[model samples]
Target: MNEQTVTRDERAGEEAADPNRLLPDEDPSSHDPDDARHWLEVYDELLDFKRKMLTIAEEALDGMRDKPARREVVDTDRRVLRAECDRFEKRLAFWRNRLAAARDGKGP
Candidate 1:
């Protein structure tokens, strides 16, 4: 989204409702629309993966009550995914702040 351009605020409860943007991002690529597009694609991929992980974890935990090893594996993998989600959320805030600053004439 460009600072000079108008951003939709009517349904702007979330970035998805704003037509001017896709998933928030950082890096020099933030200036390119494709960067945001690619970020969203990757985000969707990760989202789907996370859902699958949950289903797999549930299925694994439901089976083999005597097996405690699956819990360890599932917990570890879930933590990794959680860390990635946290990272992405922070990155999103970074990008959003950048946009706000730019719009306010406080950013390069």
Candidate 2:
């Protein structure tokens, strides 16, 4: 949800109109992994939080990027952070996918 917008105009839709926004995607009466029904919501939040944090970090590093004194350091840090962010996104996506599959009637 960390869009490339210059500002945080899109509040990530964090505050759901429906308390249990994912409730529609889930069926509590089902004897499936409804117990793990919260997994998707949790994962989505985690990813959003992480993305926000990374955006802050990237912005900080970018501010340093223009300073000759910090260029070298920030350059390296930015690269490392981007790589780590990619890995983190992939890792979270895996679990999110599984949860989605389960919610959609596929096996967890």
Candidate 3:
């Protein structure tokens, strides 16, 4: 099971008032190799985007003395980049844990 499945199961359990169904089985390490590859690829893309955003933020800050409006735009982009970074960090951690589990012969 993936994150969505687990979330759905939790919601279903809450709606049904079933404590036993609250925790969903993930078994992440059992996912196919292709699926794992896809997850990694997405994580990499997020990281790349985060880097690009950071670069933009840096460039904007560097030009702050020359263009106040550019700084504002850069700040906004930085905030968005930070948010995306946080989101992607969570995803990366999840996949890393799954990978570790797989290596250890345990399902994530």
Best prediction by TM-score: 3
Candidate 2 clashing pairs? Answer: none
TM-score of each: 0.47, 0.41, 0.58
State the lDDT at 16 in candidate 2: 26
Query: Which portions of model 3 miss their true places by more than 4 Å?
Result: 1-33, 66-71
Q: Write the per-residue lDDT of candidate 2 for residues 1-108, one digit (tens) a residue.
A: 455662453433332222333333544334345445464455466557657766776667655645774675555545544554454455445556665667787873
Of the pair 1 and 2, which is ahead by TM-score?
1
Per-residue CA lDDT of model 1 for 1-108, tens digit only, reads 664344454234344323234343435445444554455456556656766775676677667475567667566655555555555555555555555655666744
Model 3 error, position 16 (Å): 32
Candidate ranking under TM-score, highest first, comes to: 3, 1, 2
RMSD of 3: 11.5
C-alpha-based local distance difference test score of model 1: 0.54
Give the range where candidate 2 is weakest over 10 consecutive residues by summed lDDT.
12-21
Each prediction's Cα lDDT score?
0.54, 0.52, 0.62
**Model 3 lDDT, residue 67, Cα:** 80
Ranking by lDDT: 3, 1, 2
Q: Residue by residue across 42-64, what tens digits does model 3's lDDT show?
A: 77796787878778777767757
- Which portions of model 1 show Cα errors greater than 4 Å? 1-29, 88-108
